[model samples]
Target: MQLTTFTDYGLRMLMYLAAQPEQQCSVREVADHYGISRNHLVKVAHRLSQLGFIDSTKGRGGGIRLSGEPASMRLGDIVLKLEPNMHIVECFDKSTNCCAITAICKAKDFFRQANQAFIDVLNKYTLSDTIVSGKSFLEIFALPQPTNPDRHKQS
Candidate 1:
């Protein structure tokens, strides 16, 4: 049940922004910090901005910042917005699925249940919860941090 790279990067970008809500960030900075492509981050940033997750500014001294509070941003909702499709199996998309056993397949029900369970877990945590939970997540996972500490100092 792996998510696409688009969704993966989208979530990462959101987490980064949520962690430093007091400051604005740029796609180049985030991409360099994460060792990812700036082009990809730009596309993700554009989509996120369009979806009302982040606000963008142009020209000198301009950057992107979160449009809303992190506590109100649900992980499940973000995933659903970033991911173009969530079908785990061919039968999940009835419009294109021509599976012969889709009508009576118990596996389809199991898959549906599994997907729901996955979403349920994500729904339990919001961006604020991830940061405020006080858990040791940094040690377990390697994530990006701003090179310039002052870049995120409260304005």
Candidate 2:
């Protein structure tokens, strides 16, 4: 299933924060790094902060940082929180479902199973597991190189 831009941006924000555990980053910084809309990232950051996924501070010398350890942040949990709904078919939403075959659609069951499998696979991994190497990510994403590469290294 295709994820909404909101969830996609939320995940990107988390990954960015996970990579720079020692430094707080502004929403604009993340937006610029990913070449996305700053306004959109602002909303994403705000939601993430509200959800306790990131800690945000305002005013001078204030920014955002991961609130919890990356290794302890399960990808499935993150996705579940960020994703508004996991409906894969029209029959999935009971309130709005108007499909003619909803009564006998075995496809809905299969879709549900497939969706659960997707989440189950994601549940097996944590944020830390997704980051093969922060340095490589920085290089690949064209993010600014830290003054001290050693500082960004995972311990």
Note the Cα lDDT for every prediction shown: 0.83, 0.87
Candidate 2 residue pairs in clash (backbone atoms < 3 Å): none
Q: Can you list the residue pairs that collide in candidate 1?
A: none
The number of the candidate with the highest TM-score is: 2
lDDT of 2: 0.87
* Residue range 29-122, candidate 2, lDDT tens digits: 8987887789989999999998999999999889999999999999899999998588989888898999999998789899999999999999
Off by over 4 Å in 2: 143-155
What is candidate 1's lDDT per residue for 21-123, written digit by digit as tens?
Answer: 8789898977866767799899999999999999999889989988999999989888888885799999999899999998888999999999889888898
- When summed lDDT is taken over every stretch of 10 residues in candidate 1, the lowest stretch is 132-141
Error of 1 at 118 (Å): 1.0
Q: In model 2, what lDDT does residue 146 have?
A: 41
